[model samples]
Target: MSPYSQEVLKYLNLGIESELQAYVFYKKVMEKINDEETLEAVRKLAEDEKHHFLQLEDEYDKSVRSEMWAPYRDIMRKEGLPDIDEHISETHKELLARVDKLKTKREIFEVALELEKEAYELFAGFYEKTDDEEAKKLFQFLMNFEKGHVLTVENMLKNL
Candidate 1:
């Protein structure tokens, strides 16, 4: 496998894991929210994260796995690739720990805004780093979705 393919697989794995984390975070926040409007908005965000994860996973499967990327995986295993868990941000860890303690709409919106901003940055960085046209397009799509999420969360925070 080319070094490029290996790099894309690494990015896809990070993106997939991040999306799953975001989905879980939003769902947890939803449980603490009592307002119907806020809940609906958060639910939509969670669904978007789920969709992002599926999209990234599909891309990974199509791009790498179908073409015998397993050898690369084996090499990664032999070299002991760093765990995905270690890539999670400290802010996210803190938020997950305190999710249940978020008692007000403003507080919840603040957390949501932070998460959305982080996601936007993550995708933007990915988009910037990749030279492959297909990977660039995919990352750009994710970046656009994350940008919209940031806007939505910012609006929600403003209203609170």
Candidate 2:
């Protein structure tokens, strides 16, 4: 039995999928970038997406079962943990295709900014719909992080 409502679980799954897709997209974009500053910025964005995916996965596991959650926490606490599975879904492959089309630093940053804005909207909607304090807090945290990413990407675009 899950602790979260089915709707909550649905949102969590959406978040998990989106974050993983973003991480892969950023990773692919990093491969095309030659400028040191842009490469570093994109790398940071990839790292942030990876972290968000982990956090959302953790929350999902906890909602589903404690036994399923403990190993993840343990692994996360350990030194030199392995990277998350990089299985690209069909949807993710489409994202990668879009990333492949990006030809300039500005194009990359513009796409990133749009992605961050969408994430912010998603989190904001989830936060508004949830009455559960824990879920609300999680959504709020994600919203703040996404908002920050949007600002960072906007600034990067301006500098490009």
Candidate 3:
């Protein structure tokens, strides 16, 4: 276990929320798209986000029970994990507000690329913040997953 398990757990919770936001955003985007290929890709991306959210939720539960860690709500508040819900909601809002700008399939792919890049960087930071091998492996796994997402969106943009 890392000395900063509490902080790591806080980040994991934030990641969980972020993944859910991504899933919702992608689903909404799918509604706006009529291209079969783009719709299929967006559906797949939403499914990936759902899977990531479930994985993060399981990880958080494991961390909570593993070491008799105290409830972290107050610690997270004091440490200012920066209010995950609020921060992610603002991001979601920004993405929605850009729908007009993203009328083209390529433009939508570009927005997805940006979002995946953000997730990749965030997970990499979480990996660096942890001292535990288990936590490191988990974050590394997530970082790689997000990196693949970045590549997928970038490639989609190129093809569009």
TM-score of each: 0.77, 0.85, 0.76
lDDT of 2 by residue, 23-87 (tens): 76787788789989888888888778878878988889877854543433453344332343444
lDDT of model 3 at position 116:
83
Q: Could you give me the TM-score of model 3 versus the true structure?
A: 0.76
Model 1 lDDT-worst window of ten = 75-84
| Predictions in order: lDDT | 0.73, 0.77, 0.70
* Better candidate by TM-score, 1 or 3: 1
Q: Which candidate is the best by TM-score?
A: 2
Best by lDDT: 2
Per-residue CA lDDT of model 3 for 1-160, tens digit only, reads 5344788888887787667667656866776899898888888887787677767766776656542212222222232121334443465676657754666787778778877888888888888887878878878998888998898898887887
Better structure of 2 and 3 per lDDT: 2
lDDT order, best first, reads 2, 1, 3
Model 2 spans > 4 angstroms off: 65-89
- Give candidate 3's error at residue 72 in angstroms: 19
